[model samples]
Target: MAWSDLLAGFAFFLMIEGLLPFVRPDAWRRGISILSEMQDGQLRRTGFIIVVAGLALLYLVRA
Candidate 1:
């Protein structure tokens, strides 16, 4: 609820987002390449699913 809590959450998110590239740059590059090759609709659906999953997790954690 506080600004500090929001900043801390973002910091954790950044650390987690960096892990794959830090640990396995090649794999991360390959994944990005595959993502780039996806069709627009496929990419949209994949993004929507990811958003929904993240929202569901946030709801569960906050609730």
Candidate 2:
């Protein structure tokens, strides 16, 4: 993949990640609080699932 493609993807990620806090700051704070209360094991599992889901989506789109 090209550097431009990588940069574009990172920019899109930033835009998406910024949306929730921009649109609903209270909800975003609540979500962060909940995440902070999670146990390490639970957080790790959740992160793993998210990563796998993203990879699967990328594979489907690219393939």
Candidate 3:
């Protein structure tokens, strides 16, 4: 709820987001290319699923 908490979450997200590309740059680029070819609706649904999953995880962890 605090700024510090939000910042910490952002930092964690950055670290996690960086991991795949750091470990396998070619695979990361391939994934990005695939994503770029996806339709808008497909991308939106995928993003929505990810958001819901993240929220579910947060709820379980905080519970």
Which segments of candidate 3 are over 4 A away from where they belong? none
Between prediction 2 and prediction 3, the one with superior lDDT is 2
Candidate 2 C-alpha lDDT tens digits along 1-63? 899999999999999999999999999999999999999999999999999999999999999
Which candidate number maximizes TM-score?
2
Q: What's the lDDT for candidate 3? A: 0.98
**Number of clashing pairs per prediction, in order:** 0, 0, 0
Candidate 3 residue lDDT tens string, 1-63? 799999999999999999999999999999999999999999999999999999999999889
Query: Which candidate has the highest lDDT of all?
Result: 2
Q: Model 3: which residue pairs collide?
A: none
Residue 25, candidate 3: Cα error in Å is: 0.6
Q: How well does each candidate superpose onto the true structure, as a TM-score?
A: 0.92, 0.98, 0.89
RMSD of every candidate to native, in Å, equals 0.8, 0.4, 1.0
- Report the candidate with higher TM-score, 2 versus 3: 2
TM-score, cand. 3 vs. native? 0.89
As a whole number from 0 to 100, the lDDT of residue 21 in candidate 3 is: 100
> Once superposed on the true structure, which residue ranges of model 2 sit more than 4 Å away at CA?
none
